[model samples]
Target: MARPRTQLLSRDIILDAALELINTQHDFTILGIGRHLGVNPSSLYHHLSGGRDEIINALRERFYKNIDLASLQPGHSPWQSRIESWVRSYREAVAQYPAAIPILIGRIVDDVPTLAIYETLAAILVEAGVPGSQHVGIIAMLDALVFGSAIDAGSPEPLWNTTEDRQPHLHQAVASSSTPDRVASGLAMGIEASVAYIERLAVGPSDGAN
Candidate 1:
């Protein structure tokens, strides 16, 4: 008799494959996930004990683990550049895995692993001379730019839709178009300006007496 197949696929392995399937196919429906994984749909219950929620949790953790903050290079790169790079990294991640956005947004607050990343970001901002007063706003801006970029990339329909009569302002805004890269750069510049403004508040003239 042939030896028994002994490879054990854990939850992480299952989720990793699932995410890749979603990336390649953008299919979130139950049947799609089952077909993509090449396993009986019911078998997913073995790994994802709680169903979709379990899968989402696993994916979120995997995303946090894959983050390449090594590029931040704390001592070498200015905080502003690091912040921009961080935001860019997030945008790139979400663009590649659009299906994760909704899960990310919904689960962010409760997910300890995801919240730790934000905590690291906040600590960096504080160390970079950002006043405590502005921490909340800075975090909000970062979140908005990241999730907004993901939304834009994943669904461009909002940019193209017209409602000139009902939503005149949105129509006019859409008329003035820019490349996604330009938009991300503009957001980064805005973040830099906010940081600079805070730094200026701490600035003082040199003392010639010393």
Candidate 2:
């Protein structure tokens, strides 16, 4: 008789299953992943020693890797340009997996690659002459923009639903806007605003000017 073929389980396989669950259900469990993969839940332990936490970190790494890190590298371009490229790339990447955003953000990022991305951002800010005291806050603000934009990108159009009779000015503003890619346009605007703020910080209090 021929020997029975065993189901193959690896980090990729497990992570893929978990991601699928997260995409569909916005959450995942070890047993659920096992069921999705047709393996016993305990069988997953053989592969993921840290189990669910490991899977979450692995998924985080997978998505973070989608970012175009090369654009953020120290370059001859102005710091503003580099920062713009980094955020644009980040929005593009995270927007691809909007469903995973909550789960990914809910966990503290201990992954090496993910941490390295932050490290790179810190280095960029340092090079730009941004105050060390403000680095964490600045980075946090960028993250908020990126994550919020990622979720908004997946939302249906006509973001606002104000009636002209109730709020004529607000309605007119929404109606007058004719951007082809609203999400991208908004993201670009936000990134530009953020970089402008950072530029001001790097320049300091302008020698006593209010």
Candidate 3:
């Protein structure tokens, strides 16, 4: 005999199922998600307004909740390392569901908690003497690296492989033997460049004017 459905579907349940579907299928369509949960596609609208923004927001909220925000803990070394650590943590969390990238970038919330984190980091950069004008840009750079790296990590190996004769530079860069190490090196380079740029911007007397 088939087991009867006893658990009533709630918004949270729907969202949870949707996230699972996304993880398993790497597809974020509402209809696909519905099939995964054994519910009618239209039913999702009742709990999760059949809109990209709504789905994206729900996913982003879940992503943030799962992250160890404490990764931003105070450290004795330079603020750049702390910033890199935060970016690394963010990348690791989001990499779990690469299909969630578009959702993340869609609705960037700047509410109290989010603002608090941003302001805290901005202050650290300022204390490190980073220029006020470049704060937002610095954060944006970190965001790009995190998101871009997540996307690249999710991509298939064949997409990275290239014909050596046709594309020497590309082939050499994507050489399989050291691909993983190269990705790490690239991420570190991205973070370092952003941090170094901000540190340089901190040089003049107008550093903390904001």
Candidate 4:
């Protein structure tokens, strides 16, 4: 249950409403969120100067709040497991609103939570013997894979179907697979392989962007 809209509104109220809209629905606009909150669209402008971007950033902040950085500490878990945990937490958050994955990816990540995760990741990569020069490429690769996996998780079952007379081999491959999507397994192994690669390289991290 929720309280009915009132004349009094605050920035926190508006952002909570915005994230609620995003979670349950596909896309949301300023006016749409205003309507959800039973307020005039223009009223939102009094709170958010950058409008939609700010809302999305707030949504990211909300999502990251669930992630416990303390659990990802070096000694608490193996460096590889820490990486997987971060990816798992990230994917779980994004899975709540699969459509917003692209929105998050397209935006610049300057939020404190996101930056902290990146910094932790940077430090972990360094500990794993990765050169700092490759950190950008590694993060980019992980983001692409992890985010793509999240999108795939939300995809409809039977990602592909076939006609009896066409694409026999393709259909066979799909049929032989145990699940409709291999996102979970694929992502798990992908993370492991990434960790293995770093371990194999055995190169120390150099000067890097924090």
Clashing pairs in model 2? none
Model 1 lDDT on a 0 to 1 scale? 0.66
All models, RMSD in angstroms: 5.8, 4.0, 4.7, 4.8
Model 4 Cα lDDT, one tens digit per residue, 1-210: 987786467778887787677667866789898889888999898888779888778778877788888887767767777878878887787777787787787789887878998898887887777877888888887787678888888877667778646988888877788864477777887888876765666464322222
Q: What shift in Å separates residue 68 of candidate 3 from its native position after superposition?
A: 3.4
| lDDT (0 to 1) per candidate | 0.66, 0.83, 0.70, 0.77
Residue 8, candidate 1: how far off, in angstroms? 8.9
User: lDDT score, residue 196, model 1?
Assistant: 63
Per-residue CA lDDT of candidate 3, range 3-83, in tens? Answer: 768766677777777677667675467777677777888878887774555776666666667555565544544566777
Q: Which candidate is the best by TM-score?
A: 2
lDDT (Cα, tens digit) per residue for candidate 2, span 1-210? 976696588888898888789888989999999899888999998888898888888787777787767667765466777787777777777888899899878898888978887887897888887899999999999999989999999898777889999999999988898886888888888998998889888844322222
Off by over 4 Å in 1: 1-13, 16-51, 71-73, 108-113, 157-210
Q: Candidate 1's error at 169, in angstroms?
A: 9.7
Each prediction's TM-score against the native? Answer: 0.63, 0.88, 0.73, 0.81
Clashing pairs for model 4 are none
Off by over 4 Å in 3: 1-5, 20-55, 71-77, 110-117, 173-180, 204-210
How would you encode candidate 1's per-residue C-alpha lDDT over 1-210 as one tens digit per residue? Answer: 986696444687678767776666653544556776676777778877767666777777776666776665556466666676777776766666767676567753656666766776776676566667777887887788777776666554444677889879978877776655645655666667655654553222211111
* Residue 132, model 3: Cα distance from true site in angstroms: 1.6
Order of all candidates by lDDT, from best down to worst?
2, 4, 3, 1
Candidate 1, position 53, lDDT: 68
